[model samples]
Target: MTEDASPRALITGGSRGIGRALAAAFAADGYDLVLVARNEERLEAVARELECGYGVDVTTVSADLTDPDALEEVYERATAGGAVDVLVNNAAVAVYGPVAETDLEAERDQVRLNVAAPVELTKRFLPAMLERDSGHVVTVASTAGMRPGPFLAGYHASKAYLISFSEGLTEELRGTGVDATVVCPGPVLTGIHERSGRGSRWLERRFMRSPDAVAADSYEGIRAGKAVVVPGLRFRLLPWVSRLLPRPLSRRLARLIIDRGDPLESDR
Candidate 1:
């Protein structure tokens, strides 16, 4: 594609982790980018890196997605340039620990960022895509959405909403030349877990997939018009196995594996 004809992708949470990786993947594929994130410094840095390395146009909008007004500003900036051909809803927050112990405000923030943000952004951008009869919507959900999560209750529930929303949108857009895809990745080696005070280095090293791999797989799946993209063989098998097991058994297993203290805790 020529410079002016190249497709543009608008990615939320594009400053770090899977979002940053997705920006790189799209840049490498000759797509210009509009990166939205809370950290202005980080967003500018990433924008420079992608432009310098891939020779693709890059735009950055710094805003906290959890805030409705700030999110609207991001939407305005994203569409000001032109209609985005691809919208990647990757911004999310996780509040870890038992429901009773976790702060309700934090949980609410998680829901706002994880659930509402994507829905609002999708609603705003999808119309233009449908009008043009061409576009892709990619939501970054999680494997935790497949079943109940005891400790990270709110986060899991929010992700479940995203999974359902993405699938429904995909079906709705069937013949509109627009595609919607949800990427469910098991434990990724991102700062999200650490920042949320959930999981451990040992578990992450043992089970987590790299952000780059997850982004690459998600991008490829979206391009192919897949409704769901679950990275890693283990994770891809999780939903099926969870469905085969009894609900109570599945919940018990999840609690034992995820809610319990870290494996290295005993040693420490």
Candidate 2:
């Protein structure tokens, strides 16, 4: 905590979508922000908007999270302001298509950004929060983590790791002033689908939880000290649906969608 009593939050991929939505939530709560993203122009725009709208200081860090060197720089910049009160691990990438045919380099980059970067950032910032005995770590994962998605294998696996990691941290940090929460949103209207080159309209219709809704739900869960927070009423039934169908049926249905239906076809 800073002497000024203003809390600070550091969010990766804060320029758009869920990251941007969460940023608004934090800013509204009067937390100064450090918004990080690869696009300098977009990051600065978001920073300016939040500062203007919420009347809180905003710092923009433009760097690629997948790059280790850039991450160190991000740490320096984020802490220069003060100890971060909230750390949002919201940046992630989805690599679609058959695993064998996907670009190996892209897949690795996704893993580095989606899985390794959050761990690295937490390692850098979480200890200080623990020492102070006050902070929150919110990961924006997905409901896809609960079940297999054939065309989105890497993305689904990465989200599962996030869910597991956050849930474990939630248990480990109990009684400590810090808490860990993973927000699982099924699908939203976002550039992620287009960027992944696989916007499945059929899937999106199943759960239309907006990024803002996810952020709100995340806050509710975090305040309640919940380990896992699945936003959207419709999406919350996902596990039930997955369980009712046998594993074979669930997998086969996914295969049908990816094969005959081609869920990878971007409706965007």
Candidate 3:
């Protein structure tokens, strides 16, 4: 398609990491971009870079999804130009350490961003897509969602919610010219883990794949119409393999991985 005629994609958390990488992938394939993030400066920079490199239209909307009003603002600003052909619910947050010790409100905000934001955004965008009889919704869940996540209990549960959220949509949207894909990536070499306060250099180097790798895989899978995508080969199989083991042992294994190779606690 021509530049102006190209489809548009709105990606939450598109200022950096997987979101940005996915933006690049879509732009390369001739899609315009609407990027959402909290940092205005960062969002603009990515928009500029993508526009300069790909010659596609790029718009930036800075909003924290945890806020109740943010979704309305995003819907208004994002759809202003035209219909969003693809909505990537890629923004999310997590709290490390024990749940009781972690701030309750912060955990709640995580739920809002991880769960509510996507649900609301989907509600807003999917209708337009359905009316047009075309669109895609891609949500980035995590491999942690497939199993137990200990130190990151809130994060783990939130991802599980996303997995189910996307899958339910998948079944509902079939044959409607609209599709949904859920991306379940393992530890990715991004600021999300560090921002979560895990901040493990070993986790960065040892257990993680680059966000670009995941983004590329995600884009290809999405194009080929795959319903579920796990970015890495090892991470793809880990979830199902863990299921064969007992529940307690599976939880411990998940804990060990999330701990980024730290010593494990005595099994409860």
Candidate 4:
């Protein structure tokens, strides 16, 4: 399709990491873009990069999606230009310390960004997609959602909520041309861990997939109308393994993997 006639994709957190990669992927696939992020400079940089590189139209919205008013503004701006044929809810935050040690305010913000933002955005944008009878919703969840994670309890739980919400929404849109695909990626070499003040460099190097690889898998899975997209071979097996193991054993394994250091280190 020509650029003017191409579909448009609105990707949250589009200024960096998986979201940025997805923006490039969609642009290359002939889609115009609405890139949303909190940093205007970064958003503009990404928009210019995509437009210059792929010769596709690009719009940038700078807003903190955790704020209700900011999120509404994003919705208005996104729809103001044109219909968004693909909605990629890729924005999220996480708190990685023990629940008691983590700041409650920070954890609340994490839930707001990771769970509430996507849920509300999906609810608002889905009607237009259903009316058009053609749209795609891709939510970037995590393998952390598949099972209980001790050290990162709040983050994992928030992602679990997103995964469940996307799965149910996908089934609800069965006959409609609109579709929802939740992507569950394991560790990724992104600034998220650094920002969260958690994650070991050693563990990240061992298990993390590249952002580009994750984005490519996510884009292809959404195109194929898959309900769940796990980006790598090891991550793809997580849900199955979680399901097979007894709940207590699974939780223990999750704790071991997530803690990263001696549990006593937090007490020191």
Candidate 2 C-alpha RMSD relative to the actual structure = 2.4
Worst 10 residues of 2 by lDDT: 259-268
lDDT of 2 at 62: 92
RMSD of each: 3.3, 2.4, 4.5, 4.0
lDDT per residue (tens digit) for residues 1-268 in model 1: 2246889999999999999999999999999999998889989999999999999999999888889998789888888877799999999888889998999889989989999999999999999899889899999999889988888888889999999999999899988889999999998877675577765546556886788988888878878889999987778898898789898998887787666344332100
lDDT of 3 at 53: 99
Which regions of candidate 1 are displaced past 4 Å? 1-3, 201-204, 260-268
Q: Show model 2 residue runs off by greater than 4 Å.
A: 257-268
- Model 3: CA > 4 A from native: 1-4, 201-204, 260-268
Query: Over the stretch 8-33, how does candidate 2's per-residue lDDT look in tens digits?
Result: 99999899888998899889989899
* Colliding residue pairs in candidate 2: none
lDDT against the true structure, per candidate, is 0.87, 0.84, 0.86, 0.86
Clashes of each: 0, 0, 0, 0
88 Cα displacement, candidate 1 (Å): 0.4
Sort the candidates on lDDT, descending order. 1, 4, 3, 2
